[model samples]
Target: MKRHLTHLSKTILQNSSSKTLPLSRCLSTQEAIERRHHLFTLEKKRQVESVGRIEKIEVRYKGVPKDCTLVMNKDISSPYDCARHLSEWHADSNALALIDGAVHWDMHRPLSENCTLEFQSYSSTEPQAVNKAFWRTCSFLLGAVAARAFKEDVTVKLHSFPGPDIRSGSFIYDVELSLPAWSPAPRELITLSAELVRLCRRGAPLERLEVSEELALEMFVDNSHKAKQIPSIARTNGKVTLYRVEKHVDISKGPLVCHAAQVGRAAVAAVHRIIGSAAGEPEQLYRLQGVALPAGVMLNHFAFNILVERAKKLNPARSPFSPFGEDGVRNMAATA
Candidate 1:
């Protein structure tokens, strides 16, 4: 069974490689999405099998509505698991988890040791971290939508996105498209928005995985744009952060919302073609912009309209590049 599984995995990887190359303008959006979904499933299976053993970890949890110590499986007791011990509300609304009250942990990433845990929701008094995580998650999801939004012929190469920026009134993703010198019409932008809504409507929980830089590169090498960004992303820790939604893995330092259902009334408000950075840089990258309200935030259309209008402008957090070659757009909404 092990050998057969290995052979099956290798076959899928090879098939994915062959089908994805020779970028064309002939593949439909549905076909592209199907391909992406298949590759994601194969990769996720490989990742799960990589974790060979099980162990136990003690979690000393502290936070609102109540506090308790949880005995959980090591590398299996995610913050989300701890939340399940609290309440449905905690499991759903909480956007970020603070371990030892300082280390910002992804809600779905496993806990490895005994430590105090705190869950932060968007409405917390000091919600800076939660907001940032929400915003970064927004940017991350923007990438996911963009990946599936373009027709198969239009190779959507996700380069990198700046960190979350709420003050900018939106999250941003700078993507490299194989199609050159093209601008999105209003109708096209709306279609992308619909795609975002469709994806969010599925309510997939975001899962986090920490992999060595080598594994990270391996996972993303198929996407030229992301492959280009991996080295710079790993320069600081030599490890890569990956977040999953229905098996779609991508790079990000995340404390994303517990589930996609939390995003309500999403709109892909605009796309701006960014040009002329330097050689070896993506000659043209599109900044995809959007605004999202949380599920419980009952905003009147008037207020929501204002947010939509504000999000249409070019977000001024930081340009997507810096001295370290890392994307500079910091979290307008990520945990501090």
Candidate 2:
């Protein structure tokens, strides 16, 4: 099977008559990275350009510092923009923005018409949405960490991640590593955590983009696994959501934390080398697990140690692939 796959790859490369369609574009992992970034940039520009005339919408801001009205551009301003008008602290510390006291809105997504705005911090009374947003951000950031942590020789293909499940004790990321059957040592986990810390130090603002299925598949052409998932992900509304940090873009239904600086005290707890005995599937994969506390959550080392131990156990949330089935990674009810 391995030899057949290698021969097929060579054949595809040698076939000079194949039309270089956008989705059919031949690419390396590095090229895939660049292509996705370029697509995001272009999409953003297109959205901005589509607004033929600038119109103002009143946003009744109802959060910290003071309540006020913001005359924002229609379909142009986002909750993050409103936060910027309030203070840098508001803009940076907020995890999710609630519009009209309901509807969790992404910090980077544009405001459509008019609505009241409320910001939710990690410590808010109803912290469930905010916590979920934080967990999703962590999962997304873990992908970035995994992509950058790898040596150039190894190909790092991010598959996808399950929705955020804080009660399950940790955020999880499922990735395809070139090392078919490899497990990391404790020192390696520490090293990966250090890489995550370094990324947080850089402080990239997570940006969100919603595109048509055609565009989403085009963006993920180099990643077979993500491309496969796009159709199912878009089945609900024929729209695909993507999040970007710096030059990296990955799929997620997101209302991620405003900035990376909000993440603190994170550790890669363990890597579980999992094997699938079922027919017609890759035999081996690794599930990366980690525990984190938001920047201001001051848990003592003793309590945090307990969380770390719990995280080492397999997170019981739904799996990224086949999230709602018998062969599923986990049952969805567990996440609730």
Candidate 3:
């Protein structure tokens, strides 16, 4: 049975490679995504194996149901595991984890040492941090959907997304497409929105991994913009944080939501093109804007439409290519 399963996996991989070969000539977006995902998986597996010995840590979970101390594996167990110890409600609704009441950590990231843990959901009394994480995840998912929405002929290079600004009324991703003078119609926008919804329905867990600068550069080498930003990102922590949703992987300084399903009501509000250059930047950049509410937040259609309308307007986030002062540039690039 083991041999048969291995053979089956190989067969499937070979078939997929053969099917995508024709489009692989130009390094299609799908192929690039597959390559990056494969590299990420290999690197993640290597890192996991390198942890030959695992130690136990005390996790003082302070949240609903009750506050208790749970002993968990150090560098192996995550807050999600602690959530599972509580209840399904926690395992599902928790968006981000607060460590020692200070660091906002990703639910899936392993605990490095003994610390207090608190889960944050969208409905928390102060949901600002959770909201920001949700918005950032939306921006990241928007880039994934946009990268796959177009035909294999179109070259889509994802630039960078600004830091999440919930007050800005939308999440944004700036992409550069090879197509000239192409604008999406209303129907096309709806289709894109549906695709995003489909992705959310899959309920894929957002896996977080911290990788070395070398691995980060290699993973994003296909996209020049991300490759450029990785060095700047690594300069701070000496490591780059990556998040994987199903087969899609991207770079972000993140404590993103636990899963895609946390994004319940979403719409591809608008795609605005930014042309012209004050500096030596690309003349064509497309800003993909979208609005999303948390899974349990039930707003009326009219109210949701208002949000959609507001999101359709241009967001005032910094451009990826704009030359700002050192602090401004660092802030803009840190969020990407």
Candidate 4:
């Protein structure tokens, strides 16, 4: 009685005619960047417009220039704005904002309420948090520069970066590129380094934003991997943290350095192919790596070359290919 199941006919395909319409012209890497930047700008403007009324809050400055309470706009003024009022030195050197003796905030992230504020530099007494932030920023910039370095034909899909490890001697960015088996020449690496240098020279302030999971998904629609990760990232707090510099934007668990200029000397040292996966499928993942020093740090070319050579060795960061290790590669919120 159960033997009546029949397989569906194999082709219907024989009768169905297919037409290939001209493929929609794909966006160039630079165009894609501009598009994303436009979206980010519009959303940022909307958030600012959502603040119906201006309200003032006190931001008590600590450390150099003595402690004092300054009136700041609630949800409007940021640590950066406060710094600008004090001195140019405060505005430029500060990397992270220490608030109320506890929370470490992004300098560009707005002050939500009355809080005690102290700025952290690369040379602060307890600089662990600031160091992590600078490392993370370098990794983020690596993605931005590398993505822009490729030609229009090569697709660049940025994956997650493991949390910053300055001890490892390099910051990392994992990306999937269309050039599956391509090996980079020395000239290519030099070009990438030059791109990083140009970007840092722009001195763009790194803007931090928190948005809903839905919006995060919208922002990263072009990136399937990031879209997949956003749900898990937003699960904990129902929001995803994003950082933007110039026309490039990306997600991160971050208190990124105040500005790109803070990365004074840098080199795009190596890019290692990450092959093999739990699925055992051929993957196009590449780990773009670099070494960097803060603005005030001094190193001669010979000494810096030593650091570059050290960074050329494959970094020991967690591979995005490993889905089910200590933390799932897709569960970026955990590792990042």
Candidate 5:
């Protein structure tokens, strides 16, 4: 699959007259997405190759179907792989992987060392971690849909998303548009929501990768806003973690749900404008908000409508533009 994508990328680049197309061009979105996905595939392959010698580790599994120890390949096997050794139900229902007793890890992320492993589903007794992961994934997918929803004339620059507040009843992504003034009609919002549902229905696995600061900068160089935020994000660990769903990639401090299909029902409830107060702030920011429920979660239409109404209101979550100095930037990057 990686080889096929690499070949396809080369074909795309060779077919184009210009090496790089401007953001305003219609073909730019497709070309940029292909290039980034190709890069991610290559980088991931290289990292896997670097882990030359394979070693075995004991993964003490906990949860249903009885607890047992499974021998997994270190730096090669992920929690999802462990699930595969169990049952299809384990793989399909689990949303996040909990390592030891505390750390929430991505299902696709490799197990570096031996530790107690447990899967957290949306229906877990204590669903806080899974809920947060689901919310964060929703916000990330919102950015993905918004980036491609408009025509070529409209240049969409994604700023950043606030931390997930599940109790607040909505997920969000703050975006900047080239348009001076515009409002989305109800139908338009519905269209965006439908696009999101279509993407999720495809059931793409949310792939996670942690890259060096330099590689991350190269990946997001097209977006000026993300470029500026990268340095602040890399300050803590000198690396940036990225999540990719299909062809779309974005920055986030994530332990996102295993697959897009986990977002059962969702709607693009509203897009509220955020006005900048300071001199260096953006001229205008549009907050794209959405409401979503987990797969198999049955809610009546009236109750769901109430949730949608609550999501339509401006979420009181902290503004991405709020001043936090260096510390604030770090905190924002950590959650965003």
Candidate 6:
């Protein structure tokens, strides 16, 4: 099975005449991911360097190995850093950092003030927020895989994913591909799923960074779809939140669970074509759907298959293409 998947991934990007390439694909999907990733790195480094005089804050940690107060760097230290001071298990599990028992903050996002902190994991008593984060991370990962899954001549632009609806049974990504019409074969879907699992196993943190609108626009200049959304997303705060995994970067208003390795028992169940509501220039975007359980959740194969079947149905999340230019275009209402 491993050998077959390896071969399948190699050939997944080969062009098929039946699925002819679009004229718009000047840069390959991998090229675009790399370009955006570079800008994200530079912006992140700049932000880190600009946090000049190091300030200290007291973080009242409220769980595991007894509650204790930790002195950490302000605007420079993240909950992830606190976890490191606690235990490797906390660090590796990628716990969701809950601030003051009220707000759920990303494990990696810097804490701005002196606040009480607690960690939440996939197996927490109330895992709703953690579950949502996991789902969003999966959706983001799906977009990364989908982009490079296509051939160089093919234009694969990520449209958007709605906020997480676990009851809807799958995480989704709406992508506008250059192909006029194409259907994924069973093997192709398996290949996509395999690629996602492979990525998760390799271990990558879903790092978060908030960039100015100008920088966000510069980062996504290669992709017209994201460029259109940045103006609206940055309208409120003038800052766009971005998440990066390895070399892939995308937009999100995120508190994503710490890492990708938490995603386990995954499947790319189906792909359906969705019609765009943007009048005159209707888009035929493909809605890619899949289901994933957090790592360590044990389910028999039969039950997992049932979930796979359910995810094959069309997701009911509001179409990202629905009537644009309206006030308040949201940051990709993602996995969560």
- Global lDDT scores for all candidate models: 0.70, 0.75, 0.82, 0.80, 0.82, 0.79
Clashing pairs in 3: none
> Which regions of candidate 3 are displaced past 4 Å?
1-26, 278-280, 325-330
lDDT of 4 by residue, 1-336 (tens): 112111212212111111111111344445556666777788899999998899999999998979888999999899999999999999999999999999999999988899999999988999899989999899999988876776555677888788888889889998888775767878777878888987897899999888889888866766777877888788889998888998788888888989999999999999899885556333658889999889889999999999999999999987866767424665544455
Give the clashing residue pairs of candidate 5, or none.
Answer: none
TM-score of 4: 0.89
Per-residue alpha-carbon lDDT of candidate 1 for residues 1-336, written as tens digits (9 for 90 to 100): 111001111212233543464342433433434454555566557766766797777888887756778888876678998898888888988887889978888888878888888887778889887777777778888888877555444567676776676778988887777766776777777777887887788989987665676766655555655666667666778876677776456777776778888787888888887774654667777888899987788989888889989999987755455443433422211121
Model 5 off-target regions past 4 Å? 1-27, 323-330
Tens digits of lDDT, candidate 5, 109-175: 9998999999999888999999889999999999988776765445677878878998788999888
**For candidate 6, lDDT tens digit of each residue in 238-306?**
988899988788888877888888888899999998876665333688899999988889999999999
Candidate closer to the true structure by TM-score (higher is better), 1 or 5: 5
Report the C-alpha lDDT of model 2 over 1-336, residue by residue, as the tens digit.
121011111212212222233553455455567678888889989989999899999999996677899999998899999999999888888888899877999887899888999999887998888888888888888887776566444666775677776778888877777776666766677778887776776788889888999999888887776776777777779998888988778888777888887888888887776555534334555678888888877999999999989999987654543424333532221121
CA-only RMSD, every prediction: 7.8, 6.3, 6.7, 11.2, 5.8, 5.2
| lDDT winner between candidates 4 and 6 | 4
Residue-level lDDT tens digits of model 3 in 191-292: 778888888878999999889999888777677777767888899779988999987888888889999999999999998897745454567889999999
Per-prediction TM-score: 0.81, 0.86, 0.90, 0.89, 0.90, 0.89
Better of 1 and 5 by lDDT: 5
Worst 10 residues of 5 by lDDT: 1-10
What is the RMSD of candidate 1? 7.8
Error of 5 at 179 (Å): 1.7
Q: Is candidate 1 or candidate 6 better by TM-score?
A: 6
